[model samples]
Target: MLTAAAHLGACAGGDPGVGSTNPFESQGNSNSMSGTTQPGSDTDSTPTVGGSMTDSDTSTPTGPGPGSDSDPTGSDPTGGPTTAGTTTLPDPDCVDDDGDLHGEGCNAGPDCDDTSFNSWQSCGTCVDQDGDGFWVGCDQYGPDEPGPDCDDANPDASDGSDCECAVTPDAKASDTCAEGMAGALGVIAEGGVVPPIKGSITGIDNGPGNGQEDWYWVEFPEAMAMGNRPNAGKIAATFAVNPGDPTSPDYRFEVYTACNKPAFEGLAATYGPGTPPAREWEFFDAHSPPNPNPNPNPNYLNNVPWPAKVFIRVIRVANDQSCSEYTLQVSRLPT
Candidate 1:
């Protein structure tokens, strides 16, 4: 029996079987590794009893192991192995040199200059110099006649759509009341000043040739220009060069009831003194005026009260051409 078992062991080493009949497999893989290789191994799996573990059949299969660079995971969708040292790169098109969070062709507007930081965006040949969404030399407020840009240098003033003076030139056509109706700045609200009424000052290049002046018509909410109403509504007017210092103002402004030859006054108390809605406040004593006052003018048509017209004349005085720009603003006082 011992002789027979030795012969069987040697015979099975040549072709190890994994079936129930093979004595090597009677025990598990670890226990049966004496002479033959484990079940389901390569054809050269068998080794000499006293020799090293090498494939006897040199024609053995060669390939990457389960997850050895050959599809790192068995379930890899691509079904291909990943390269050794791969790196991710940024998108070349999404360039933003300004570091302003907005990229070229990918923001509010196209970046005109990718090399320079904080540069303006291209608006045709022009650019939004102030980043105010309004373009310089391009987005001028015009339809009837040609007009200049709506202060593209200032970020606060976009297009002149809201201002009483639509940033239209001082005098557009020939036959106008002074410099024509520059604009109508809506009604005066209770508290703060309305949007500034902007107009270009007098210069051979800007305003009309004959005694250049810009006129704006506005209305107070209530009718009290001449103290006709019990409760009065008054307004405070302020004038400043568009790019001037309030500390040292350098513009001249006047308020009138009409755009007449000489312009009539809007006074109350049946004329003389005690005018309720201080119609013309040239001094700006920081005091007061009435809104619902009556038109103190001898000709009521010229100086009508309340909802009547309040014309503001902004003219160039001792200011440079650069300071030739002016803004007239009105605020209502709670009487």
Candidate 2:
């Protein structure tokens, strides 16, 4: 009876396989056995599997598991709660201030002209606040179409019109001689009109009866001396008081060959009171003989060489306190 019982125990302890009864021999196996198990029984306690282990007492884990810190989802790798939802974006049309097909303000788009809905689309019709019939935004307009008014404030200064202020003439003494010589008043050309010069006599005189004097210069270019022979040797400058006052003090006119300032002592010729109201001062080379010719052919040519530059002085004789208006005429006598 003892032998039969021993044989029965041996049969009950079925053949021990090649390795232990751990069913999950390879790590690649999905179902692994880890908990305690009956020595020969086929059943195993809840498998503490290679992956996450499920607690028999509770459905969820009390604390974070192995890879809880590394996993971005913050849940057990095997099986745990997860989040699933959708994110809504901003509306496309709400922020588009300018409908120029471009958005403004943030990442929407680059639309500089946000004020007008489609100003960029129709740039030809830009704003014209002054209403001078010209658009103020763009400079590239047709010649006939006025645009880019220089002075938007003044309507009179619109496109195609003068935008700058008129320049006024200011004549001051020493204005000419400051450059080493008086400025050339004008050239001696036949039929040329010498503009009248107006200036004050106040404070210009050295004394009560010394008379006030003004200086001027004139140039005779070689071109003017080329043609007429008789006139080539004679350059005459005439002076007259416009609206001459009979009671007005006599005015003297003198011509000089040099431009020496302060003392125009060159004194090539002189004409004044006792002479006709309209006097013609002549200039000739210094080496030439005194002019023996009469009226129309007065002694005007200078002793200086051709293409000469002569200096002139106008003096208001003593007692002439009134401002004077004078007209000067320069001409090359006809042959």
TM-score of 1: 0.33
Each model's RMSD to truth, in Å?
42.6, 50.9
- Could you tell me how far off, in angstroms, the CA of residue 205 lies in candidate 1 after the best superposition? 13
Question: 80-131, model 1: which lDDT tens digit per residue?
Answer: 4433443332333555665433356543345555543333332343445657
C-alpha lDDT of all candidate models, in order: 0.38, 0.39
How well does candidate 2 score on lDDT at residue 323? Answer: 33
**Most accurate candidate by lDDT:** 2
lDDT of 2 by residue, 37-108 (tens): 112211111211112334333244345557666544444567574444333334344355543343454343
